[model samples]
Target: MAKVLVIAGDFVEDYELMVPFQALQAMGHEVLAVCPDKSAGDKIKTAIHDFEGDQTYSEKPGHAFTLNASFADVSESQFDALVIPGGRAPEYLRLNPAVIDMVCAFAASAKPIAAICHGAQLLAAAKIIEGKKVSAYPACAPEVKLAGGDYADIAVDDAITDGNLVTAPAWPAHPAWLKQFNELLNK
Candidate 1:
């Protein structure tokens, strides 16, 4: 089974993280719920809601789960893919030296990475999107371009595996995102 790491921190789009997590679990993959040492709570919240909603759903950490490891300690060699959920989490995660370095390693190795919503912020920080085709929330177009990725209005599940990288828009694009991700891991 593919071992996927889902990076969650403060403002992680609740569903952006949960949907793919549940989907990957249903497929029998080992999904690791990870949070930077600094993300709010154990499970983290959504920019809209703490639980992956635009309203106010928050998943308190230690309720039933927690991040597998700290960003500083996680090793890319152990993961098949890296998933970064959108929301304000990326905003802060982008500034974390550990998160930035880990992300850079993922891209350098061409490991499959799936990002949604504001998660583009993390990529922009890592400078891993250059010359690659990607999609994200409209507000992040400039960041995408600045990071060197080509922005598009494509569906989330378009399966953009360009030499081991994957990108998505947001939660509403989960179905397509999950589908493409499943395919990537399945291979």
Candidate 2:
């Protein structure tokens, strides 16, 4: 089974993070869920399905051993692939130097980097999309282009390979990310 590391921060879309993650696990691949910080008690909070509520909810950060391992502690030699889930998580994760290095390691090793929605923000910050062709949330199109990627209107499931990169528009269109990501992972 391929080892895949899922990088998520707070406000990660519940479906976006949970669905693909479980799907990857169901496929018999080894998956690790990593958040920021190395803690035994620190928890990442996620709001219940509403983006505009003052009552954002959160699950107590998972057990430190199971909750998060520092991005700084990660090594490219340890994982086979990377999947970035979207949400406010991207906005914050993009700022972490360790996470940036982790994202860069994926491309540095020529591993597939799959992202959706605001997840593209993290990719954009890592400068991995330069001169690459991919797709993301329409709102993020300008950002993607600024990072050197061509925002594609095409569906993500379609096998459009733009120089070793894969893209999906948003969380709602995840079948495409799933298809394209699985394809890249198995390769």
The digit string of per-residue lDDT tens for model 2 on 51-165 reads: 3444542333321123445554667679988888776688888899988988998888998777876788988999988878767756788998898887777653342456446
Tens-digit lDDT track for model 1 on 137-161? 7678899988888987776445355
Per-candidate count of clashing residue pairs (backbone under 3 Å): 12, 2
How many clashing pairs in candidate 2? 2
Q: Which is the leading candidate under TM-score?
A: 1
TM-score, model 2 to reference: 0.81
Off by over 4 Å in 1: 38-41, 47-65, 155-161
Give Cα distance to truth, residue 111, candidate 1, Å.
Answer: 0.8
Which clashing pairs does model 2 show? 43-61, 157-176
